[model samples]
Target: MGRKVTVRDKILETAATLFYNQGYVQTGINQIVAEADIAIGSLYKHFKSKNDLLYSYLEQEDIRFFTTVEEKLAQKKTPREKLMAYIDFRIDQQKTGNCTGCHFIKINAEIGRTDDEVQQLVQKHKEKQKNLIKKLVTEIQPSKNNFDAKQLTEMIFTMIEGGVVAATINGNTRSLEDIKKLADKLI
Candidate 1:
């Protein structure tokens, strides 16, 4: 038999589900404890505060998001294919996730300004994503007459971000599909 899940795992798992489905500010510790079926003391034992739980959640999400993206990207043979795969992955996620916006983006909008730690975590995650795109851009278009790899990366990244936001607003994946088409043209 496998090891049983700990109370801390239960709390974290419940928080992740709640935070993803509901807004972070809207998800209370009591709700997490109630859904997790754990004592209030158990949550405090694992996390000092709600912010602490959020921090842990963000860390966990970062690991999971990047790991999944890297795995998907690894399956593609070419840089353009990898980039397209990234866009398609996001589109599929949006469709399956009920059009919920980016997790980090949502959390950042909630507490990015007030919380330095959360802000840093969000910034670092975005920077890493941009760097990955930059690396791919370098591979796809080594030298353009007027545009550098960094500039192209920013444009592509912006398009992807805009696509996600648009898709969320429009309640469809057309924006994401359009962005992919634009990216195809650019590449």
Candidate 2:
């Protein structure tokens, strides 16, 4: 017989969906176990508390974002092309029926109550996004204000994040189209 997966894993998966769809505070541990069809004790066995589960969710999401970016980047021919693919990928995510708001934004709002691990994870993820934009900017604009590429990369990041927020709020995709246009101007 195949080995059964642990109940803790099941609870975390259910908890992640709940936390993602419903806000973190709005989703309770009881709700997670009930939805997971597992005993309440199962979660505590794996995670020290709800905070542990929340941190794990944030980590998983950060991994998902970069992993998707890498997979998409590999198919393109140049850094510039890969960068366009990055914007198109965001467009695809905006079109996804499940996208609420960017998970990082939501998680950022909750960091006041979160542990250092998750807060650090958020900080690290933000740095990665900035760096990715910096790499793309390097390919297009070799000359810049500083070695860090902060100003230009940050401008692009704002446009990208703004598109996600607008899409979530209005439930319309015009913002993504606008972003693509703006990116064309940037490049």
The C-alpha RMSD in Å for every predicted model, in order, reads: 1.7, 3.1
TM-score of each: 0.94, 0.86
Query: Among these predicted structures, which one has the highest lDDT?
Result: 1
**lDDT (tens digit, per residue) of candidate 2 on 1-110:** 98786686677678777887888889988888789987777778788888888888888788889999999999998777887788888878878844477777777776
Prediction 2 global C-alpha lDDT: 0.79
Quote the lDDT for 54 in model 1.
Answer: 93
Error of 2 at 15 (Å): 1.4
Model 1, global lDDT: 0.89
- Against the true structure, candidate 2 reaches a TM-score of 0.86
Task: Give the residue spans of candidate 1 off by over 4 A.
Answer: 1-4, 142-145
Candidate 1, residue 135: CA error in Å? 0.6
- List the global CA lDDT of all models: 0.89, 0.79
